[model samples]
Target: MALMITDECINCDVCEPECPNGAISQGDEIYQIDPGKCTECVGHFDEPQCQQVCPVDCIPHDPGHQETREQLMEKFIRLTASK
Candidate 1:
């Protein structure tokens, strides 16, 4: 599943740079994770980098954007190929 930044995000500005996929960005209120661009760090790291550095613990698996490991890997591949 893609990770989501909840409303609880404190805008610490830490998580945004931690996202390897560049999925997190500043929204009107808080940091937002683009589901289409998110891979939960599948091709980049063993764990989501954003989640590790977020002080608020607001980053969580997006159940609404669920995907299996294989699916996430495919998404990661697509993202990298475009770069």
Candidate 2:
């Protein structure tokens, strides 16, 4: 599953740079995680980097966007294919 930022997010700008997939971004109010680009750090790290770095622990598993490891890897590949 991908991780999502909840409204509890303090917008402290702590999670953005920690995302290996570049999935986290600054939103109008809170930081947002792009599900399409999020891979849960499957190919880059042992765990979701954003979640690990989140100061408020606002990042949570996105049950609405469940995916297998293979699927996550595929998404990661596609996201980085252009570069």
Candidate 3:
């Protein structure tokens, strides 16, 4: 599953650079994770870098956008593929 940023985020700008996929971005107030680009760091890292660096633990599994490991991997490949 992809991860999402909750409202509890302090917007401290800690999680932005940690994302290997560049999925995390600063929103109007809180930071947001783009589900289409998020792959939980499947191809780039051993684990989700954003979640690991988050101070408030605001990043959580997105149940609404649930996907299997295979699907996530495919998504990762497609995202990284150059146009």
For model 2, what is the error of residue 3's alpha carbon versus the real structure, in angstroms, after optimal superposition?
A: 1.0
lDDT of 1: 0.92
The best-first sequence of candidates by lDDT reads 1, 3, 2
Segments of candidate 3 deviating more than 4 angstroms: none
Where is model 2 more than 4 Å wrong at Cα?
Answer: none
Cα-based lDDT for every prediction: 0.92, 0.90, 0.91
Across 1-83, the per-residue lDDT of candidate 1 in tens digits comes to 98898889889999888888889999999999999999999989999999899888999999899999999999999999988
Residue-wise C-alpha lDDT for candidate 3, range 1-83, written one tens digit per residue: 99999999998898999887889988888999999999999988888999899889999999888989899999999988973
Best by lDDT: 1
Give a tens-digit lDDT track for model 2, residues 21-78: 8889998899999999899999898898888888888999899899999999999899
Off by over 4 Å in 1: none
Q: TM-score: which candidate is best?
A: 1
RMSD of each: 0.6, 0.9, 1.1
| Count of clashing residue pairs in every prediction | 0, 0, 0
